[model samples]
Target chain A: MDVWNILEYCAWALAVLFGGHMLIDLARVDSTYDNDLLTSSREGEIELTQELHKL
Target chain B: MTLSSAEPTVQAQASTQGGERLQLLRVLGPGHVWALGVGIVLVGEYMGWNFAVGKGGMIAGLVACWLAGLLYTCVAMIDSEVTSTVAAAGGQYAQAKHIVGPLMAFNVGLFLVMAYTMLEAANAITIGFLLDTVAGLQGHSGLHQPPFIVLTVVFLAWLNYRGVLATLTFNLVITAIAFLAIILLFVSVQLGASHVPLDFSAISTDPLPYGWLGILAALHFGLWYYLGIEGTCQAAEEVRSPARSLPYGTMAGIMTLLIAATLTWYVCSGLIPWEYLGQAGTPLFDAARVTGSTPLMVLLFIGTIFSTLASANGCINDASRAWFSMGRDRYLPSWFGAVHPKYRTPYRSIVFLVPIALIFALGAPLDQVVTFSILSGLLGYTFMTFNMVMFRRKWPLGTIKRGYVHPFHPFPAILLLLICAATYFAVFLGYGSQLIAMMCFYILASLWFHFWRYRFVRRGDQFTMPWPRPQGC
Candidate 1:
């Protein structure tokens, strides 16, 4: 194979390795606690119920 | 100033600080953010491809930077007018959610987060690149290796994790040293100019020499220098007087940075050739190094480190605010909006932000990430400019308080829209590998996150940039 083809193979190999690493990183999401995501609000912020009611 | 009369001011401070506690030192003045802008601009110049363009390119790029500044100026004006009417927190996400429906606002907020995350990573990678370049010169060949990038990413993540006040104080010192370094370079160049002949031929050429194509390309990079101009508007509520200070601070920061950057480019261009700048790996540092002054070279290195650190710190502060606003609106999750009891900062959201930022910084190449940064930032500005026009019609002129207004009404506004649209289309066409890859990554992640947010993980209510109204039918 030509240099271009060989380089293409190398690029593909790197892509797969990196892509797998990213996926595995995502897979390791810490779900042990319900309070993990930055989504939860305090006990009584006014806008909470108001925004919910709009939905 | 009677001590007894000071009671009310103290009481007001006590209530505001005690009740609506936010990140300490977040309500920074325009001067601080302007310093941040300087750091960002110097970094942009470091990556700038002036050598490739030659004298003509340098002139073209500076003009483009001015135009990009104009676009930022317009957005800041619109934001100032809107800020006075609402007493709520959350910067662009809040304003957009209020004006537009929540769905559209949600998209913008998500895009904003993506923009910051990508940029944080991009900046980290750039810092790593500079470090590697410097190291390679010191005879270390493995400078481009992953370990270096990973280490820089970890360092930045640690700084961010220390909370807002620590970051801000640290940034203040970094920015101060950076400011001193840049000034020293300017002074040194001026003093040494007697040895070199001055050149003004770079600017005396035909304006728009490359026609619309060159103008568009320059504007694309120009937008890069003006990225954080509107950061103040996002942090308006945090400031002491949002009504007065927000408008003044936002505009002043953009203009000051523009002037400083223009002066730096002009002086540096005169002292050192554009060809040399473009060819050198770290052009700005190379400029100082070529001067043959060891003290000056050391100063520039210190300045670069300061610039990179301050930029990263400022970005983390601004980025987390976007998430905090979204969380409060119930779009992301309530936990994002949480303030640390003692520090009164967005500790949880910032915690989530730094790692994502590090991941991008560690993985991506500098140029790829910079292109994506410009793309995402311009997209945000374009929408904001368009939002202003729509806002003029939707909300009466009277509703927008007395503050800064664009010099020309629809003309400048229309021009902004066209420029923004053209740039967005150019990037989407996949000009660079990293831009194309990151755009795809962001779009896919946004879609996935949206489905998860609205479908399964959504809590009580969803928030958007331009907030949607209740269904009545």
Candidate 2:
């Protein structure tokens, strides 16, 4: 195979490599963690705790 | 190559399970924010703005550049005030969610994702085309471009997956080089160091082939000059201090784009005639070639490639943040919200968007991809005009703290609206069907949002910021 063809194969291989790594990591995280925990965030958490700091 | 994950710069000790966290790393400063904003936009100065020159001749192109500059200056002003107060990663989406309502925010978030992703698609396609051009010059015209397109998305997504600091720092370096390249070309042309002297009379010759209509037509393409400066706000949540960083970075970025755009137009128009400049794929590089100077040509070539890469890198960063923010609020599936335990990024969102970008990059025509991106951004800017008016009405200055306040309040908003209306007409003149198609696409997405996705959104919880009872409410 020529260099251009080899380069295309390398790109495909890297896409699979990085893309596969991400999928595996995503599955690992999804399977290992609870659904609620993975989905949970404090985006709108009201600052009830910070009230004491207000002078 | 093994990637090392980032350590938390600011610890969130809220979760006992050591897992659930809402925030990405707040490691970026104004410099990185500047990089992210400028990086996404500098690519246009290299290639796309010439279309404006083509549309209306040289003088018309200049007028459109200044008018769009005014439009974006208004955009930066409105975004600064709203984003400083909101202090969220999704930028305009978070502002709409809080000020307007859930439905508007959902659409805005979708706009952000689509705009940045399509721009990413455009950039990746450019890289492939750029490589193909290089291959052609080297007597090997048979280079397969799909691999390079695939390679661009994969590599940049991988970088974004690692951390925000490194990704943006990399953006900062390359963006600065690209910006410098424009300055170098300007200096070289002016000093008569280029192969040919600049022709001042090009501006006077055939200045407006289509009369006043050409200026209106140029407005649509003129957006390429400073299209993505408002994207600075997307880095808000990741900044060390959102209020300070967002406004400062955003303003600095707009100024940089302004000077860069003007210089680019001046240099390229002097070197190449408008008819040729308007349609040339790589106008700056072509300008370099006109001088017949190999070093300058090489410099412009490197600049184009760097600018394209920086844009794609910035797009991956912004698009993932928008998707992650939407997911975190359950505006979409919350599964996409998960930050990596080791790297402290929205890894799922970053990884997820790679294939979506790849689909468009591999499939669509470049102009189609770019048109969609520009229209999406235009829609977002139109939303900001209302967003600014409502923010002032609801909070009325003293009710809540803002890092920066735009002056001459209603003037910028009114001007912005007028400019937006004019540009809409401009787009309609050329791409009436595409404009209609885009509107229909948004309408369908909105319907889906109302019928299906609205149930998942935490409508009440989105109003988490501390504020007095909104004035009218």
Note the Cα lDDT for every prediction shown.
0.57, 0.85
Task: Give the Cα error of residue B125 in candidate 1, in Å.
Answer: 1.6
lDDT of 1 by residue, A1-55 (tens): 4443344355445645544443343334223212322133332133222223221
True contacts kept of each: 0.10, 0.45
Interface RMSD of each: 12.4, 5.1
List DockQ for all candidates.
0.07, 0.41
Which residue pairs show collisions in model 2? Answer: none
Candidate 1 lDDT over B1-473, as tens digits, reads 12112333343345444453222223455555455444444455544534223323666667666776666666666666655434245566666755655565676776667666666676666666676666667666554434444444445544544444456566667766776666677777777723455465655654445655665565555666556656655554344445556666666666666665665566566656655653455555766766767787788787776677677666766777778777766677665665543334565676677568766676566666667667667757766776766666665454434444445566666777776776665454446565667668767766766666655434434332222332331
**Number of clashes in every candidate structure?**
27, 0
For residues B1-473, write the lDDT of model 2, one tens digit per residue.
Answer: 00111345324333425554545666888999899999999999987888988988899899999999999999998888888778777888889988988889999998899999999999998888888888788777778899788888998998898888899999999999999999998888878877677775866767689899999999998999888888888886677767788889989999999999999988888889778898999999999999888889999999999999999999999999899988888888888888775567888899889989999999999889888999999999899999889989988887676778899999999999999999999888888899999999999999998999888876577886776778887
lDDT of 1 at B49: 39
- Say which docking band candidate 1 falls in: incorrect
The worst-scoring run of ten residues by lDDT in candidate 1 chain B lies at: B1-10
TM-score of every prediction relative to native? 0.75, 0.95
